[model samples]
Target: MNFSSDAAILYWSGSNINLNFKGSEISAILKDSDTANYYNVIIDDSIVSKIQLNTSKQTYLLASGLSYKKHKLQLFKRTEWDKGTTSFYGFETNEKTKTLPKSKSKKKKIEFYGDSITCGYGNEVQNGKDSGTGHFENNYLTYAALTARHFDSQYSCIAKSGIGIMVSWFPKIMPEVYDLINPNDPNSKWDFKKYTPDVVVINLLQNDSWIVNLPKNEEFIKKFGNQKPTEDFIIKSYENFVKSIRAKYPNTYIICALGNMDITKEGSKWPSYVSKAVVNLNDNKIYTHFFMYKNTPGHPKVNEQAAMADSLIAFINEKIKW
Candidate 1:
């Protein structure tokens, strides 16, 4: 996050700006790189509305007609980095109402490094046509976010739509962008000590399964020229990525997760690959948890995402000391 000129830049999915104030209404000064970005206006702990951003800087009406009492407001970014960045200026309150400091954050912290599943892509879709505007993506409704809310843990997400461990829909994989403070800036480094998570969940490999199969795909060709990565190569790549994360958070529990996609399907080998990587590490702290395949077209919907959160919570309860 870059806080300059009395404003901050929210560049990734799930990033937010929270304010507590006593007023009947409140508005925010904001700007978006893309005019079509989305944001969830959460009052207190419940989401009240989903607002779209404009390309130019302006004051956006967040909430109105509330009791003239203290209220908590959280503006959560719903889209990922590729959706665009948001610049937040400040909030405006009616009358003599003043802004108050937010409540203390939870001591338990969890960091998620995943893909579209964690970004809640296609979550808002109903019957057919599994695609929509960026409004369809809501990070707050994802299994990752639900899991964090359940544990009352501070959430840190670094996820993109088509990212994977071995290969992505794009040339940049998780290993290359995991440590950057800004996803698009290779020179930017995230200070590990700034926020050390007690638990790190890595949900990936769904994209790799498809992309690696198409060895001639642009993404595959860019990541691995001419040759398709063998099973051994895939397993090794997953291991190396986890090891790099372990090097950063030595004592933190690392959950090497796969997905509710074809990656974890009945006959799929991605689960075995993740299990193999965990066995190779031989570290008691690192564990494997794979969500069952949804067996439907497109991404997992909200209910499916909820099921995943429930499964993950159950796994965490049984395996870890959380």
Candidate 2:
């Protein structure tokens, strides 16, 4: 988030603001890159509404007719960077409302570096188009978010749709953009010491599975020199990416995970690539896990995402002490 200005710019999915206030209604002074961006209006714990942004600055009515005693409001960015950026100026409440003092606490941090699955792409759609409007995406509904919420962990996500470790649907891949504060700005850098996670999850390889099969893909040729990447190359690429992360946080537990996609289908070699990479690293803190394949087309739906979260939450409870 760019906080230099009065209107802080929120750039990633699940980037959000929480307000505790005693009021009958509340409004927010916000603006966006465009109308494509959407935000989840969460009161207390449940999501009450989803809103879009406008080009011009305006006060967006978030909720009304509250109990006027105490309320927890979360204005969360549900869409990804591609959906457009949002600038938050602040919030406004009715004349009788009183803003509560900010609370402080230390919480365990968990960071996720993944693709569309982590971004919650198409989670709301029911057998809809492969790519729809921003309406269908909700990062808060993803397994990553669910796991974070389950442990009351502070969350940070560096993810985009169609991205992989080796190659992506576009020319840019995760390795080239992972450290960036702004994904499109290669010059932008994120200081790792600012937020270190006790547990780090890397859910990738879905796009790589599809892109590698398409030898004619523009990005494939650009990355693989007009040939499919070998098994050794793929494993090495995974190793190098995980190694880069370890270099940043020496003691953090790294979960090198793959699939809930065809990448983990019965005959697929992608899971092996991840396992072999972890084996080759010989790192005690790093572990590999593969999500069960969905056995259907398109991204995982809401129920499927819940199943993934359930599986992952169990894995975390068993494998990680923190």
lDDT of 1 by residue, 135-221 (tens): 788889899999999999988899998998878887788899989867888998888988899999999888999998897799888
How far is each candidate from the true structure, as Cα RMSD in Å? 1.2, 1.3
Query: What digit string (tens of lDDT, one per residue) describes model 2 on residues 1-322?
Result: 7774587888888898988898888999998888988999999888988898899999999999788688888888888888777889999877898989865644788899999988988888976445646888889989999989998988888899999999999888999988987887888788999888999999998999889999888998899877898999999999999999999999999999887878899999888889999999999999988899998778888888899988888999999965
Assess every candidate by TM-score: 0.97, 0.97
Task: Show the lowest summed lDDT stretch of 10 residues, model 1.
Answer: 127-136
Candidate 2: misplaced stretches above 4 Å?
A: none
Angstrom error of the Cα, residue 98, model 1: value is: 1.7
For residue 241, give model 2's deviation from the true position in Å. 0.8
